[model samples]
Target: MDEMQLRSKIILTDRFDETFEQLKERFSEALFYHISADDFLVEHAKEVVDRAYLTSDREKVIVLSAKRFTPIAQNKLLKILEEPPSKTHFILMTSTKAGLLTTIRSRLPVVDMTSSKEEIQLTINLETLDLAQLFSFLQANRRIDAKEAALLTEALAKEAMRSGKYRLDEALLETFAESIRLLDMGSPPHFVLTRLCLKLLERKI
Candidate 1:
């Protein structure tokens, strides 16, 4: 699914898979288990790029999703993302970007993804929910990092702008700026989101 993105400058989120489903038809599937640097001996760790543990660049990239491991393992995969081999592209599919270490998040660009039509329509068609509704979903979906939440929030803000009546972008920007501040202070996302929701609802009226 991602092979197409490799051809040029493209940021890949899970949606990339949809874009390349047909293109990747014949590409062999190569999967790998998460091997923590601490768990694998130094000697074995050095050999990880080899076939037994890791697949060659010609095959599909190593996918590290939130289901199998913690943020730490994704951090471990940073070495590969940092200095990717000629044909290797690593993909991380996690609900929360908050889980990833800052250094790791910095290395990757957030691919702006079009949220599901359900979400788009929900935000557009439904008039009951306000700006805070989107933030709530951002909180649940972006557990990995503040930046992930921020990225998705920002993307959705753009969507909000396109949707007609709400002053969503400004409301969101203000709310998230505070959210990031709390995040920097080591506050949990729920706490930060709570604060953000209050700010949003205050202005939503």
Candidate 2:
């Protein structure tokens, strides 16, 4: 492919424009489709992928918001992902992977949005959270894949209850799991932390 042709394949979708500009520096050509979720747009968005794929030769890719994925849209994209055109690349980057259709998730090449990562809050008190507990914390407070995070968090919470150091309320355990799932979906850290702390404190011996 010629240099201009190569540049048109990359479709970057993110609130951060500067990041895309910097990312495009590595490639000579990329087709930029700037879109947002509107009632009319979502219904019409599938064409964007189709046109972008057909019109350009560099590669076929879709960058979409995790919270915005729909089953129909994903299934449509999954076809392209499953049987990629030769010399085509499909990269999907999302802050949360939980919303993606399982089929689409399985088919596409998932890449991290390195530009979107938030720095770990320096104020996170680590003195009390050992390795084992910290792992449980991440599992509980997942900002992606909250269902799995809830399961992991419950398992660890159960373990703590079983050890006899704390009381176990099954209902509260489930509630805590739900809170963790919400936190994964983009709740503020303070609210999540507060909910978690109250839950843990309730079971205190």
Candidate 3:
């Protein structure tokens, strides 16, 4: 087993297939149970764990990609996660680590695959965003959910800091970062965005 496969149980990755393929190469004899998106349920976790132990192979690998584990489901799998079969390995993949609980995160080492640059749709041109443009952008994105809001807030904060358009200092920058964290914790998107917009307006030079 590779050093990464030995230590990390959870992997936060964007290039899911690429990582899986690499694992397949390294552990060629390993039995792989790939549970993705919709297929990641409590029952599926049970099945995967059962199958993992059945193999008796030296290398047992389970790959989960973009699977949103509910609080209940996470609890159900906690035991298995805490103490899996000998020679068993798990790779939990997600676009963001926010969805996973701190309890689960504490048990696993994270392999962050998310890149530094925000997605194009999430990008904001801070230099050109006056009140009118900000309002227009908000109007266009009025229906975003908490996750989208979180991602947008992060991107916006980065743009604001990098552009230095508002001459944002550390305290103000931390406020923007806090807003992003709030969005991640399921804060109302409209309220979060509105407050962020108002703060940006106040500091706009």
Candidate 4:
């Protein structure tokens, strides 16, 4: 490995250009493939990953900018991500992890952007939300995987803490933690979320 080679395969960043420039400087001889959102697809990933490296001496890097990778595309990429060709790397750039599948997010190491993170608005207030509202909310977020569910659980927990309406105690925190653990164990997203909500409802009682 060269002294200036990329230390990590996956980099999570909001400032795609800045990180990209740094990579270019580090791997000057490395082959670079820049794919925009419109250009990223399952076929594209297959084409790129299957091809032989242009330069054997240096690495090949694929930078996906502003692209929301579809589940199918990410799945197609999972094998190569786990085991890439001798000197190939992938850089995925996205504003948030919500759209990305849990499998992919877990694979990469996140890099902080130079700029502060943009605050994302909560679509529903979990504290005041009732059973009916919860179902409606879950309906809108259909087909989410276990990891995505865990992320959602963390977001809801944060919102609950900020709301100050519910009491945050050891039990509540433990339940939320368990929810995330269950997600990693292959539990269904809906079941895990629903169970977490029920446990949270206890705060009212």
Candidate 5:
């Protein structure tokens, strides 16, 4: 592995397989061990740690891709990430950074691989969000599934920040994070979105 490919890092992308393939191409010569899941749990983390400890003279890359990573799983992997085995590198790929714990994020550099084209186009203007607009937006997206809802939630949060129209204190920021979690846990998309928008409306500057 070269200088750029030596360290463990997080790759943020909605297209996990595509990004994983790109990483494989980048490190063609290295031995690749991929562990992909919709949700990375503690068992998966144990498998990764086990793979990391395996004796290997050549470069070994463990690619762990998931839609969401549980806090317990992330906590389990922290020690090895901080001090990985010789010639072992980890690449964590996820749809949204909100699902990751700060401790896990602090351990590795995050590279956003998502293109502008992949970002959700927000229909509702968060800056000028009124009750009528909010209700209309909700009605328009009443049938949104969890996956789309997650993307929309992220887009809305970004738009709110970019517009500079909200008093985004830590609590407000945490609401966004919690919204993502609720979506992942199979909460009704419309309900989660409605709650988030109301909170944002209340915090408008």
Candidate 6:
């Protein structure tokens, strides 16, 4: 990677720890500030913004790794991301890109580091999604916890897009992002899954 490539960017990867370690090694010479969390909340976003604003003559890289980023947190950091401080770079590492808001996605270029060969096998096909199938799928995964729910939501979004059978627009994409936010906020996994599937069904082509 060249000096220009080391600038602020979003990195999509399931293996957060490994990807982060590689980045640390790559930016070995620069000052580094890592703020990692299972769920990045508003406070973490504030910390990132604070660290970014600190004057730095040398290259400073702020690595933010999280399984999920709340909408509020992402929004709060939008301004700083759009116009970063001098010699400051940001590397956002996350498990999936579905949860990221369009505003944040637009500000930073995404570098896909995910190497998972396993395809997402969805129980209810988004292309042929119906009420009965949706109910059946929900019932089957009724015991799913929050973390699993987040992963499932990501898979569903991915499968829906890959199927190319839905009228995917910004509104539909935001629903998927909101589903993740709901799950992170302790909402029932089944409920989130139900709402997401229903939204997809509504937009099916």
Candidate with the greatest TM-score versus the true structure = 6
Ranked candidates, highest lDDT first: 5, 6, 3, 4, 2, 1
User: Model 6: per-residue lDDT, tens digit, 1-205?
Assistant: 4423678999988887888778778768888899999878999999998899898778999999987777778889999898888899998998688867768888888888888645546777677788899889999999988878877888887787678898776678768877877887899998898888888899998
Work out the TM-score per prediction. Answer: 0.37, 0.42, 0.58, 0.54, 0.69, 0.73
Candidate 3, residue 35: how far the Cα is off, in Å: 1.7
lDDT of candidate 2 vs native?
Answer: 0.46
Task: For model 5, name the residue pairs that clash.
Answer: none
Clash count list over all predictions: 9, 5, 0, 0, 0, 0
Error of 6 at 164 (Å): 9.2
* Backbone-clash count (model 2): 5
Q: lDDT of all the models against the reference?
A: 0.44, 0.46, 0.68, 0.67, 0.83, 0.83
Q: Scored by Cα lDDT, where does model 6 land? A: 0.83
lDDT of 2 by residue, 39-123 (tens): 1123544764565456566544333333244445555665666665555554343333433444565454444443443333222
Rank order (by TM-score, best first): 6, 5, 3, 4, 2, 1
Pairs that collide, model 6: none
| Candidate 2's TM-score | 0.42
Model 3 spans > 4 angstroms off: 1-3, 119-150, 153-205
Give one digit per residue, the lDDT tens place, for model 1 in 42-97. Answer: 34324434523443545445443331223344445557667766666554443333
lDDT (10s digit) by residue, model 4, range 66-131: 534555677787887778778778777754443455567678765645365334455677657787
Q: Which regions in candidate 2 have their CA more than 4 angstroms from the true location?
A: 1-15, 38-45, 56-67, 85-88, 114-205
Q: Which stretches of candidate 1 lie over 4 Å from their true place?
A: 1-3, 7-23, 26-60, 67-69, 117-205
RMSD of each: 11.2, 11.0, 9.3, 11.3, 4.9, 4.1
